[model samples]
Target: MNVAEVMTTRVVCVDMDDRLTIVKDILDKAPFRHLLVTEDKQLQGIISDRDLLRCLSPFIGTRC
Candidate 1:
């Protein structure tokens, strides 16, 4: 089956200048594991749950 068939259309995205607090809220509310990062209405990159967790490592736990 094509991924588009099941992929979410209402994606949560954030601007490069967006605060981490807002991004965290979206991540907590969004059901999907990925967020499309955009700038000036253009796609920049994809941020997944893994990326968010990695960012939290500095404050939460260190990776070995």
Candidate 2:
């Protein structure tokens, strides 16, 4: 199947300077787990659910 056929039409993104809470909220409600990071209307990077979890996870817990 073509990417257009299966991909979601609704896209969610966050600004480079946006807080982690914003990213977390978007990720929590978004159908997709990934959020595009943008600056000056340019795509800078991407963030995923796991990435957030990793960042939020306690340092006292699993391997670093």
Candidate 3:
């Protein structure tokens, strides 16, 4: 099967300067696992849920 056959059309993207909180929020609410990082309307890179999770603080979302 081709990638287009199963690919999702509704993509989720984040700006380069966007915060982790925003990324986390998007991932938490969306069903997808990856996000396209862009700058000035140009694609810069991709960030997966795993990548965000790895860089997140253990105390994230916790009252410290």
Candidate 4:
């Protein structure tokens, strides 16, 4: 088996400046684990669920 055969063709991407809330939402709603960060249609970096969880505040979505 090859990478292309196992990899997803329908990619979900986010902007470089997108907030953690947006990233969290996307990841939460999607079945996939990775999100591509793009700038002006160019790939900037990749973010995973683990990355979002680490960067997001623990108090997020909580009422204090």
- Clash-forming residue pairs, model 1: none
Per-residue alpha-carbon lDDT of model 1 for 1-64, expressed as tens digits? 9999987898788888887777788888877778888999999998877787878775545555
> What is the per-residue lDDT of model 4 for residues 12-63, given as tens digits with 9 covering 90 to 100?
9999998988988988899899999999999999998878766666655568
Residue by residue across 1-64, what tens digits does model 3's lDDT show? 9999999999988999999989999999999999999999999999988888668756655688
For residue 8, give model 2's deviation from the true position in Å: 1.3
Error of 2 at 4 (Å): 1.0
Q: How high is each candidate's TM-score? A: 0.77, 0.82, 0.83, 0.81
What ranges in model 3 sit over 4 Å off? Answer: 57-64
Count of backbone collisions in candidate 1: 0
lDDT of 2 at 50: 83
The local lDDT score (0 to 100) that residue 30 gets in candidate 1 is 75
The true-versus-predicted C-alpha distance at residue 16 of model 1, in Å, is 0.8
Query: What is the clash count of model 2?
Result: 0
Off by over 4 Å in 2: 58-64
List where candidate 1 sits over 4 angstroms from the true fold.
Answer: 58-63
lDDT of candidate model 1 versus the reference:
0.81
lDDT, candidate 3, equals 0.91
For each of the candidates, give the backbone clash count.
0, 0, 0, 0
Candidate 4's C-alpha runs over 4 A off are 57-64
Task: Tell how far residue 28 is off in model 3, in angstroms.
Answer: 0.2
Best candidate (score: TM-score):
3
